[model samples]
Structures are given as C-alpha cells and as structure tokens.
Target chain A: MNRNRWLLLPLLLTLLFGFSLSLGSVRIPFGQILTILAGGDATEPVWADIVWNFRLTKALTCLLAGGGLALAGLQMQTLFRNALAGPDVLGLSAGASLAVALIFMGQAAGIRLLYEPSPWTTALVASGGCFAVVVIMLAIAQRLRDNVSLLLVGMMISAAVSSFVGILQFVSKAEEMQIYIVWTFGSLGSLNWPEIAVLTATLAAGTFLAIRSAKALNAWLLGQHYAQSLGVPIKRSRMIIILSTCILTGGVTAFCGPIGFVGLAVPHLVKLLIRTSDHKILIPASMAGGAALMLFCDVLAQLPGSTQVLPINAVTALIGAPVVIWVILRHPRMLP
Target chain B: MSPDTPTIALQTHALSTGYNNPVLHLLENMSLTLHAGELVCLMGPNGVGKSTLMRTLAGLQRPLAGSVTLEGGPGMPPEHQVAVVLTEKIAGVNMTVYELVTFGRYPYLDWNMRLREEDKKIIGQAISQTRIHGFTHKKLYELSDGQLQLVMIARALAQDTAVILLDEPTAHLDLNNRVEIMKLLQRLARETGKAILVATHELDLALQTADILWVAGKDKTLLTGLPEDLVLQGTLDEIFQLKGYDLKTGQIYHTAFRNKTVALHGEGYLYRWTRNALERNGYNIAASTPTDVTLTIEPGDRPAWQLRRGTATNLYYSLGELLKALPK
Candidate 1:
C-alpha cells in the first residue's frame, strides 16, 4: 500500500499530462503529439502549434498553478490546523482580485491610471494586493492566537475587499467590466513565456521554503505549543509559511485569476488518498496530486470536441465543492 | 532536594508566569526544581496556572519575570533537555504510532528530518518502553484516549530529553487506564532516570505514584515536597480541598445535612462501599450503634446487607434498595 501510494500520484500525473497534451480542441493523435514533443514534425503544421504551443503551455501552466496552489493550501491548513483552510480562505486571492478589478475597472471607466493595462502590470498590482492581505493576516495571526478567529477575520477582509470591487464594477465601463469578469472567470491559456517564467520562479522558491519547513509543519500538527516545545522557531515558521503561501497563490492568481477550489480541495484529497500528515511525503504528494487534478480540470474546462470552453474557476468549484462536502461527511471527526 | 543528585533536570527561579495583555497573573515568585529519577505530580485547582507553569517550564511560553534553566553546561539549548506531552488533541493527525513516535526525533534531526540509526533505535526503545510495541503499526486515531496519551509520552521519550513534562496526562482516561498510565510514568521516571513532571488532578494516583508533589496554592505560591510530606503539612488539602472532596483521604466529603443516623458495621470492601452509599444518601454515619437503624454488611459471593430498625429487620442484596427502604 505504501509503495502503491507513492507511485499512484506520479503515475496519474504522467498519464494526465499525456492526455492534456494529446486531447484538446484540435485533437492531435497521441503518436503525433509524442513525435512533436520529440522534435519531429506532425502531419499538419497547425497540429504542431495546437499541441506544442497551446496544449503544452496550458498543461505546464496547469501543473505549476495546481501544484503551487495545492502546496499553499496544505501549508495554510497545517498552519491554522483547520480542515477548511485554503489559500483563498485567507483573503489573498480577494486582495489580488481587488487589485485586478481596480485596474480593469479603472481603465473601463476611463479613469487616469499610472500604468498601462498589461499582464506584467496586472501581475505586479495583484502581487501588491496579495502582499497587503498576507501582511494583515500575519499581523492578525500574531495577535489572535486562535485559528477560527483568524479565519473569520480573513473572511471579513475578503468581504470588505469584495464590496469595494462591487462598487468599482457598478460604475465601470461595459467593456472594462467584461474584461474584469473574464479575469475573474480565470484562464490558463493566455500566459505567454515571460508570465510563465515569473510563475515558475515563484513556484520554485515557495515550494523550496515549504519543503524546508516540513519538519516544523509536522510539529505544528500537535499544535503551536507542541511545535515550539520541539524546538521549532514558531515566529520564523509562521513567517515562512505566510511568505510561501503568498508567493505561490499570489503568483498564480496574478496570471490565472483567482482560480478557485484547487487550492481548497486538492490538499484534502491528497491527505484522504495517502492517509498521512507527514509533510515530507505530503508536500510532494500534494504537488503531484494537485497537478493531476488541475490537468483533469483543465481538460474539462476545455470542453473536449467542442469550441466552447467553460471557465476554469467554474469547473474547479463545480468539482471541488462536492469532494469537500463528501470529505467532511465521511471524516466528520477530522473537522473542528 | 536529594543529596546524591547534584544535577537538576529543570529549575525555575522566582518566576512569574501569565498572559500580560490583561494584566492577569497566574503564578508569582515561584521557585522549584525537578531532580533526576523522580516523578513529580503538580496539583492545583482549575485555572490555577498549572498549565501556564508547565508551559513556562517547558519554554513554550516566556515567563513574566525571573528565569527557567536546564542545569546542563552552558550553550546547551533548553529544548535539548526538555520534552513536553500536552493534553491537546493531536487532532486529525493521520499517522501510525510508529510515525507519531518518530516525531520525537525531530529536534535532533537535520532540517530535512531524516532519521539516523541512533534516532531509530531511540524511537524503538520509546515504543517498547511505553508498551505500545503491540500497536506500533496502528493509526493514532484508532487508539483509545489512554493509548493516545501513552503514545504522546512515547513521543516525548523519543525526544531523549532529560526532563519530560506532561499536562493532565490522565484527564480523559478511565480508572484502570488512568492508574496504568500513572504507573507507566512512574516506571519510566525510575527506569530512565529522567525527571518527569505531570500536571494532573488525579490526586489518588499522584499520592500513590509521585515521588514528590508540586502544589499550586491559593496565595500565588507554590508548595513542593514529597506527597506524604505535602499531605502531612496540609498543603494538598489547602490546594485541592473543594466543597465536598478531600484529597488526602481520597474520599468524597459529604456536606449534605442529614437528619437521620445509621451505624455501619462489618469489614472489608463491602462495608466501605455501604458506608459510601449511606453517606451519599444523606445519612449521618455514627460511631456506635444507632438509636434504631443499623446496617450490617455481610461479604460473600452473593453478599447481602441487613438493615435493622428497632427490631424490624430487612435484608437487601444491593445498597440501592437498602437505602430506599430507610425511614425518611
């Protein structure tokens, strides 16, 4: 069972990666996709662009975003020791959305803006917003000393930011409102190379920090006092967790919009499947699980054999919400 | 303090420990020492800074004033010497006993938390010593509260610290489990020669098992001595005596005013339980034969009690009916 648990994730992830590469709007044959991946030309040149450019990038983006967000969710869950804790639950995504809403809606309303509406500007603005929320949450975590209260405070910040965003949308231009709405729906296909580079770098740094803090996270499973008693530097560990979760979810939401539910549900699914809380295994397993699930979700969002693609965020929630509910029902004792 | 043991595992000097935001103080000017090979039980009323003191001593919380030091050589870390087993639910942690015990090696492991041969040997010894080797492969969630408590102790043992502190280790266990756990702690202390301090309300178990007692008193003071010494000095009663409970005798003192009197006779466990039942039912126990009602306990396979009231005799198998038949 242990060996199978270890192999199951990477195996599924590889299979899903292959499926994501081969099955999209223009279904490239599996052989051609492999051939194209190996530097050989396909029967049609469009197949190469479809498979290599669009499908391959989308798959990689899904992998990174999914893996990063899941790891962030795992850290949040462990940090708070709350079963329901997720990256977005702390209002970071709301902060990013608020930033995106401000720029997109500001442009639509013909308001004077300091910078042009570009991906880099949006990424920077989103990161700034994410950083702001993370700072507030960290401050609250220090003072509150209770996870539930901190969670509620996060919700309040999210609600407050969302209300402001509502105001921005109410007075915005129709075209700009449409742009903000589309961003909120989220997409994985729009990122070119530079945005992916930014995301990849952030993902690497965040995962590194998280993996380094695995021992501390395990200690935290017994609560903060137990962790501190075990020689874990509580304040330092909290800082690293906050910083890593911010960089990860912030970077992803910057590019893919607040891609929902993947962060919330993926970690729980991994834990349920693997049945271990050791972050040494959990961290990497969750990464792989998140990647596979996100690729699968991306495939669903693509609406195989159809031109009409659904919102990535909608697909995640549509799938994620039920799994969360089922997990809660099945493992009621695990929930606080 | 023992004359032969020169080294103190943990000591707190003039320490004031509490949360300061609201200016509430729990313990003040407390000085105590835990020596090697001694099992010490800390007793106090609820909300009496027992947990706080334990936390402060374990270095989980900073003291408001004064200092806590492990009496090893300089530059040795406090965590390297002290390990704590908290009562807090390890809740939702999905790991086997072996896995949970492995975390005890965390302080000694590298940043990657890879266990070396020495760590594994220590972990194995902890499991066996705690007598949890039978269920080493069992998930913690599957263990009963008593077993879980033992596993936490095992985890602490795995830390290989000189001092082990536990907060209410027997709080949620049954009578047999509680006594068993207390016995285990006592044996571990003597066997490993580690100083073990257990903060608990199990007065009976503490009286039986503790080599010394740390009593949190009413006046922001701490009383430390042998359990018998504390009892003789009335320090245990001063801290643990509640409205209707006596810590020294391990008996429930009934304050209920009874207008009736009953003289209980016979010997052994049956006589003791009969007296308990009579006291619980608002009957004043008399030193000699009563005016009318006299309860005689007879011990046997199907033992019965005879209640004689002015020559009107009644035989009852259970204490319940005998008490019910009493004159109101």
Candidate 2:
C-alpha cells in the first residue's frame, strides 16, 4: 500500500502539471506547445511567448510557493504539537505584508530608503522584516509555557500589523492603492527567474533541515521530558524548527504576497491521506500534495469560460474552510 | 551475601528530585538499591515522593545531587536496562494495541526503522503474557482502565529490560483488577527474572506479593528490606508513626482512648484463638468486662464471649482443637 502511494505522487504531479499548462484563455495546440517548449519554430510570436514566458512561469511559481508553504506548516505543527498551528499563526506573513504596504504606499516619508532598486530588492527587504518578526515570536514562545497564550500573542501581533496596513491603504493615492490591492489579492504570475531561483533554494534548504530532524520530532511526540530523556537537545531542535519555518514562510511571502490556506491546509490533507506523522514520509508527501492542490486552485482561478480570474486566496479559502470545519467537528480531541 | 554481589539492578547515591530550584523537595538525600529477580513495592502515603522516586529511576528527571547507575547484566545495554510505565495516559489514543506495543522497539531500531523477526516475536510474547492478545487490534480508547494498564505493561515487557518501574499502575483500577495486576507483576518477576518495582498505597496487597519493600516516610528517609523483615522489626509502624496498642492482647484500639481497658479470661488453644479473634474485631481481650457494661451470651459447653447488648456469640473452635482438649 505504501509503495503504491509513493508511486502515485509523481503520476499525480505529471497529470496536474499537464492539465494546468493546457487550460487557459488562449488554447494552443499540443504539437505547437511541444515545439515551442523545445525551442522549435512557432506559427505566431504571441502564442509562443504566452506559452513559454507567461503560463509556464505562473505554473512553476505555484509549484515552488505551494511546496514551501506546506513544508513550513508541517514543521510548525510538530513543533507546537498542535494541529491548528501553521505559518500564518506566527505572524510572519503579516509582517511581510506590512513592510510591502509601507513601501508601495510611500508611507516611509521620514525614513530614508536604504536602496532604490528593483521589485526583487524590495522583496528582500520585506523578507528580512518578516524573519525579524518570526524570530521575536519564537523567543516569546520559548519563554511562555502556555500554548494558548502564545497563540493569542501571535494573533495580536498579526492584527497590529494588519491595522498598520489598513492605515497605509487609507492614505495612499489611487494608483498606489491599485497596486497594493492587487498584491493583497495574491497571484503566481508576478515572479521572474531570479526571484524563482531564490525561492527554490530557500525551500530546498528548509525542507532538508526539517527532514533531518524527523527522529527527534518522533521522540518529542511522547512529551518534552520524555524527549529530553531520549537525549534530544530541546533548545537546539526548537531553534532549527523556528529557523526553517522562517525561511520557508518568508521565502514564499517574499515572492507571492501572503497567499492563504495552502500553508494551513495542505499539511493536514497530506497527513489524512498518508496516515503517518513521520516527517520522513510526511515532508515529501506534503510537498507533492501542496503543489497539486495549488495547481488545481490555479487552474480554477483562470476560469477558461470567463474573462475574469478569481483571486488565488479566495479559491483556497473557499475549498479549505469547509474541510477545516469538518475536521474540527469530527475530531475535537485533536485540536491541540 | 557478598558486599559486591553485582546483583543491584538500580542504585541511587544521595539523590534529590524536585521542580524549580529544588525548594519543595519531593525526595531528599535518598540512597537505595533494587536487586535483580525481586518484586519491590514502594509504599507511602499521598505526597510522600513515590512518584518522584520512580521518575528519577526512569531518568525522566535529573537528580539534584546524585547518580543512578544501571548495571548492565545478561548482555543488555545500559540504556535498555530500565523500562517505566507512568500513571499518565498514553497520548496516542488512535493507535492499536499492536502499534503501541511495537513502540517499545524504538530504542533498538535504527533510523530507517523496520521491526526484525525477533522484535515481532518479543512483542507477540509480551502481548500474550500481559493477557491482552485478544484485544491486540483494538484502539486504546476502546479499552477499560484495567485493559489499558495491561497494554502499558505489555509495552514495557516488549522493551526486554532487566528492570521495570511502574508508578501507581493500579491507582485507577478496581479491587479485583488491582490484585490481578499485582499478581501479573509477581509472575513476571519469578518467571522472567526481571526486577519489578511498583509504587502503590495498597499496603496489604504489597505485603502479599512483594519480596522487598522500599518505604518512603515524611522523616526524609527511605527504608528498604524484605517486607516481612520490615513488618517484624516494627519499621513499618515507625514509618507510619502509629501508636496506642495493647501488646499482650495484640489489640490496636483508638489512640485517643489510652486509659480505657477491657478484661476477659480463657485458656488453652481455643482460648488463644478466640482472644485473637476478639482483638482483631477491635475488642481488648482481657480478664473481665467492666461492671457498668451490659453483657449478653448463650450457654455453651465452654465459656463464650459476646458484645454488650448484642445476641452474637464470638467463641468457636475447630473439631481438632476440641478433640485434643477432651479430657486428656
């Protein structure tokens, strides 16, 4: 049964990739698509550019961002030993959103900008700000022994950052408001190759670190004291988890503007499907499951029948919220 | 016995265990040894450091000042020498008895883990030995308290350690289940040659089953010896701080009524037997009753004892005793 499931991952990935690439507003023939991807002759320049540059980049962005978010969520779940814990629960994405809003709305009037550079450079600054917030939250969680209090503090931090962004939106001019609103909706069509490279590298590093800590995570499931008796360095393991969560969450938010629900929902879906919490299996399963779910949502977002595209966050919440409600009602004991 | 007999399965040298700066000392400067193939009971009143001692022996808590050495015997690693079952419920309620039992193999398996044939056999034997083989596929939450206790013991058995420690394993069980659990432990000690240590408040049951007793008292001392020796030497009474007993009649009446006394008379084997029965029933067997008391009895071939204003007779003897005393 396990081997068959392992084999099914790549098959599902290929099918999702193929379906995502084929269904768009403009339909390109399979033969022509293949020729264009292979760097061969194209009947028209626009069709070739749309297939190679626009749609393909968007698909790859979904793959990277989805995998990164889900892996970060899984690590947070094990670290907190709470099923509801996720990347957004730590306020990292809210911090990035606030930083980007400050830059886009020209709210940094008094403070001199360090560097006037490209969009990627602005994203780097935002990622650094997000990581700072995550570090502060991690330190606070270490000091507070109670889980509920830690969750409340994270929510308060998120609300504080969100209120600051709301003020920025109120004062901004018309064009800046348009840009901020578009960024807030969240899309996979914005990144270029350089940003994609950075996202991929960060996700790979974070995933590797999480996988290496799988045995320690199993020991921790028994409880903190039992894990200590098993010779796990609790402080060091917690630091590694916090650092990995920051990298994956900060990287995805830097590129995709705080896409919701994929980080929170994909890990849960993978665990339900795989029936195991061992990260050796859960990490890769979450990576593939997250990518598939994101691509499926992306395909829905680009409603081929209509000219309008739904927001990615709206699609995720529409699918994620009902499953979350059902999970809570069915397994109330698993909430913590 | 040799001083260096090498039979000590666990030893503590001046150990102290407590939480947060060691202000509330649960255990203090305690030194003791648990030998192999012995059923040791740790008996104490509530809040007298029984659980704390078990946790320290299991290495779940660090001692404030001492070392616990697990002597490797019969070719097992020091890490595998001790297995503990705590009073707290296991966290994985969804896991089956089989899966939970297999978790004991965690300390032996490698990173890319798979249970070997020998591991499976050991787990199977543990399940059968704990009498949970019939419920091996059932989830933990579906079992009763006694059944769950057996599953926990089965998990500990699968660990294949030389020493087993349990902290109040029978605290939630009924009377029948408590005896069954203690009997299982005693059988395991004799049959498997594992040194079993359990902390419990069931003093009489411990006296029946345990070979040695580790008594923790409020005086901050730990006393260890054979259970009968501890009782015969009056060490158990000293630890409990009990007073007010009649030595000649072997009666323990209320401590507050020290000046109150009752007297009765009888002779021979039947007399001694009846006197012991009266003493156990809370009457001071003496030469005579007080003149102010009301007494009731029926006529018999021999003298009879009875409660005041009650119809019940308290004197009886076996046919053998009667025949032996008949006009010889």
Candidate 3:
C-alpha cells in the first residue's frame, strides 16, 4: 500500500501538470501541445507561441511556487511542533506583502518612486520585505528560549507588518490600490524566464536545506528535548530549517504575490495521501503534491467558458480550505 | 575504571542546575556517578529539583556550573553513547510505532534514514525488549498511555546507549502499567549493561525497583545509598514525612489505634496482610503471647484465625468476620 502511494503521487502529479498546461482560454490541440513540447513546428505557429510563452511558464510557476510554499509550511509545522503553523507563520509572506504594498503605493504616501510596474521591480521590493522580516525574526529568536515563543513573536511581527500594509492601502490611490489588491490576489503567469530562474534557484536552495535537515526534522517529532538527546544540534538544525522556510516562502511571495492557503494546507494534504510524517519522504512528496494542487487550483481559477480568471488566492483558499477540513475530519488527530 | 571494575557510565561533578528564566536554582554543588548495570531512582517530593537535575543530566538544560560526562570524556555524550526517555508526550505525531522506534537509529542511519542490516536488528531487539512488537504498525495516537510509554522506552532502547535516563516512566499509568514500566526499566538496565537513572514520584515502586536510591536532600544535594539503607536510616521518611506519612514503618501519623494489644502469630504474604488488617483496626501485636488475648493463625488453602479467650475458643474463616466479631 505504501509503495503504491509512492508510485501514485507522481503519476497523479504528472497528469495534473499536463492537464494544467492544456486548459487555457484558447483550446490548443493535444497533438500540437506534444509536438510543440518536442520542439517540432505546429500548424499555426501562434499555437506554439501560446504553448511555449504563456501556458508552459504559468504551469511551471504553479509548480515552483506551490511546491516551494508547501515545503516551507512543512518545515515550519515541524520546527514549531504546531499543526496550524505554515510558511506564513514566521511573517515571511506578510513582510513580502508589505514591501510589495509599499512599492505599489509609494507615490500616494508622498514618497518618490522610480521603479516601473514590472515584475522585476515588484519582485525586488517583495524580496526586500521578506529579508526585513527574516532579520527581525532572527533577532527575536536570539532572546527567545523556545520555538513556541519565537512562533508567537512571528505572529506579532506579522500583525505589526499587516497594520502597516493596511494603513498604506487606506491612503493609496484607487489605481495604486487596484495594483496592490491584484498583487494580493496573486499571479503565476506574469513572470518571464529570468524571474522563473530566480524562483527555481530559491526552490533548489530551500529543497537542499530541507533535505540536509530531514533527519533532524524526524527527531523533532519526539519534541525538542528528545531531539537534542538524539545528538541533533538544536540551534543549528532549527536555523537551517528556518532558513529553508524563509527562502521558499519568501521566493514564492516575492514573485507570485503572497499566495494563500497553499503553504498552510499542502503539507496536511500530502500527508493524507502519503500516510506518514517522515520528512525524508514528506519533503519530496509535499513538493510534488504542492505543485499538483497549485496546477489544479490555477485551472480552477479560470472561468470555464470565458477568459476571465478569478484571483489565484481565492481559488486556492476555496480549494485548499475544504481539503484541509476534509483531511482533519478524516482523522481528527491529524494535526501535531 | 578498569574492565574488572564496574565502569562509571555517567558522572556529574559539582553540578548546580536549574532554569535561568526565573533564576531558580534546584540542585547545588552535587557530585554523582552511575555505574553500568545499575538502575538508580531519584526520589523526592514535588519541586525538589529531581526533574531539574534529570534534565541537567540529560543535557536538555545547561548546568549553572560543573559538567556531566559519559565515561572519562567531557561534556555530554552523543546519541550513540546515551539515550533518554523523557516525560514529553508524543502527541499528534502521526507516526507508527515502528517509525518512532526507527528514530532511535538516527545516529546510525544516513541522511535518507535507510536502515542497515545491523540497524534493523537493533530496532527489532528494541521492540522486543520493550515488548511493543504487537503494535509496531499502529500509529502513536492510536495507542493507550501505557502502550505509548512502552513505545517511548523501545525507542530509547533502539539507541543502544550505555547510559539511559527516564523521568517518571510510570507517571499517568495504572497500577499494572506502573509496575510493568518500572520492571521493564530495571530489566533493561541489567540485561543491556546500561547505567539508568529515573526521576520519579513513585516512592514505593522506586524502593522495590531501584538498585540505588538518590534522594533529594534538604540542602539541595543527593543522598545516595542502597534502597534498604535509605529506608532503614529514615532518609526516605524526611521528605515524605512532611505529608504526615512514615516511609520507615509504612504507617500514617494521626491513625488512632485501640489500646488493646493482641498477640497474632502468622507468616508469609497472608500473614503480613492479616497483621495489616489487625493493626488497621487499632489492635497491636506483641512479642509476648502471655498477654490477655492470644490469637493463633492457622495457615491452609483457606486460612483461619483462632481466638482463645480464657479457654473460650472461637474460630473465624475470614479476617473481616473476625474483626467484626471483636470489639471496635
């Protein structure tokens, strides 16, 4: 049964990845899709252009951001030893949101703004916000004795950063607010190759860090003291785990605009299918599962008959929240 | 230490330990050593620094001063050298018994957590050692409290350390479970040749199971000796006596006894309980049988107590009936 789950997860993920690529506003033929993917010429070159430039990039972004945020969430949940903990638990997304909000609403706040509304500039400011929160959290972690306290501190920082964003929204122009609000809705399609490369690099770094600390994460299941007794250097392992969480969470938030529910929901969702809490399996599984769920949600966000796409954030919550509820109901003791 | 002598598996030198947040110091300037194949129980009343000291020894908390070492090495030993079964509840972990036990092989396994042949053998032995093979596939949340405690001990056993420390392994368990856990710890210490230390509130259980008693003293020190010596010397009474209970005589203060002193003759477990029943009813036992009332015990499948009161003999089958027939 366990071996079957291992085989099934990737098979399901591949099918979703293919299905996500196929379903856009314009209906592309599956033959042409495969042909275009194989680097062959399509009957209409525009079909190849559409498949290469838009759908493929969007689908890959879904894969990277979804998987990254979900892995980040798993690290946080295990590190904090909390069921409700997610990538946003350490205020990374909130910090990125604040930075993006600041950049979008800067002119209305009587600040001189030089940047264009390009993905690069937006990503730059979002990254700035993410680092700012990381620095603040690392500083607080020094004085704090326990992870629970640090988690509480992260929540407080999130609250403070959120209030700043709320105030910025209140004074901003409708056009500026619209930009910020749309960013909050989250995006997967706007990124070109360069941004995706950076996202991939961040995902790679975070996944590496997570894998390096997989044993520590497993030992952490016995709680902090037991983990320490098992020869895990608590401070170092915790820092590595936190670093992974920050990079993965921040990278996704920076490029994709603070995607919701995926980070908070994906680990639980993956565990439901996999039936184990072992991080060695969970790390890769969650990444694949997160990617699949994101693709699935991105497909759901597009209106069935029209080009009008709902907010990616709304689609994830609508989809993620129920799946989590189902997971919890299926096993009342699912959370740790 | 030489191989001929018992190895000092764990030792602490002048260790002062406690929490730093509230600035409370628990144990002060204490030196203690634990030898291999010995199970020592640290006993004391509440807030007596037994847990703080255990935590200190387990290397969970930093000592205010001094150091704890395994063998002749400095600082704490690695996971392969020492294992600890803590009181922390493994709640909502979503791991099976086998998975949790496999955690004991953390130091042995690589980053991927794949077990070698020997590692698998060690884990199997640990499961059988703690006798939790029955539910190896069951999730932690599915097990009862006693069963979960056994799983935890099994995980520790899988560590295969020379030194093991358990903090209240019997806590939150029923009477049978309590004995089972303590007995398991004692057996593990002997069979594995490990130096095991237990911090517990179970004075009676500890007295029976521990090879040595480390009683927390009034001056923030450990009073270490054999269990019988500690009990006979009234060292065990000092702390528990504050609650008006005597550990030496196994009697409570303010238990008013009747002035009647009866001579009851008996032996073995039944005799002991029979004497207990008589004493509970305020009747005293005397060495001299020439006193007013002499009750002779008749031992059999169904034991009987014979009462000879000035040549008027009477017999009762049960202690309950005999006590009732006598005056209050």
By TM-score, the best candidate is 3
Q: How would you encode candidate 2's per-residue C-alpha lDDT over B8-58 as one tens digit per residue?
A: 888888887765553677777888888887899999878888887888888
Q: Distance from true position, residue A133, model 3, in Å? A: 0.8
Ranking by TM-score: 3, 1, 2
> When superposed on Cα atoms, how far off is each prediction in RMSD?
3.3, 7.3, 2.4
Q: Give per-residue lDDT, candidate 2, residue B164.
A: 91
Judged by lDDT, which candidate is best?
Answer: 1
Evaluation by DockQ, superior candidate among 1 and 3: 3
Model 2: CA > 4 A from native: A1-13, A29-45, A105-109, A114-117, A137-181, B1-6, B43-50, B72-79, B87-96, B115-147, B174-177, B201-205, B217-328
Instruction: Give the interface RMSD of candidate 2.
Output: 3.3
Residue range B1-328, candidate 1, lDDT tens digits: 5678546888888999998888878999988989888999998889989999999999888899999978674487767889998877664457888989998888888778888889999999999999998898888779898899889999999999999999999987899999999999999998998999999998888989999988886788888888888777877766765656676667888854668888778898887888888778788887595368888888899999988888789899997788789887
Instruction: Give DockQ: model 2.
Output: 0.19
Tell me the TM-score of candidate 1's A chain: 0.95
What are the per-model DockQ values? Answer: 0.62, 0.19, 0.64
Question: TM-scores across all candidates?
Answer: 0.91, 0.77, 0.94
Error of 3 at B87 (Å): 1.0
What C-alpha lDDT values do all the predictions have? 0.86, 0.75, 0.85
Question: How high is each candidate's interface RMSD, in Å?
Answer: 1.8, 3.3, 1.8
TM-score of chain A of each: 0.95, 0.91, 0.96
**Backbone atom clashes (below 3 Å) for every candidate:** 0, 6, 0
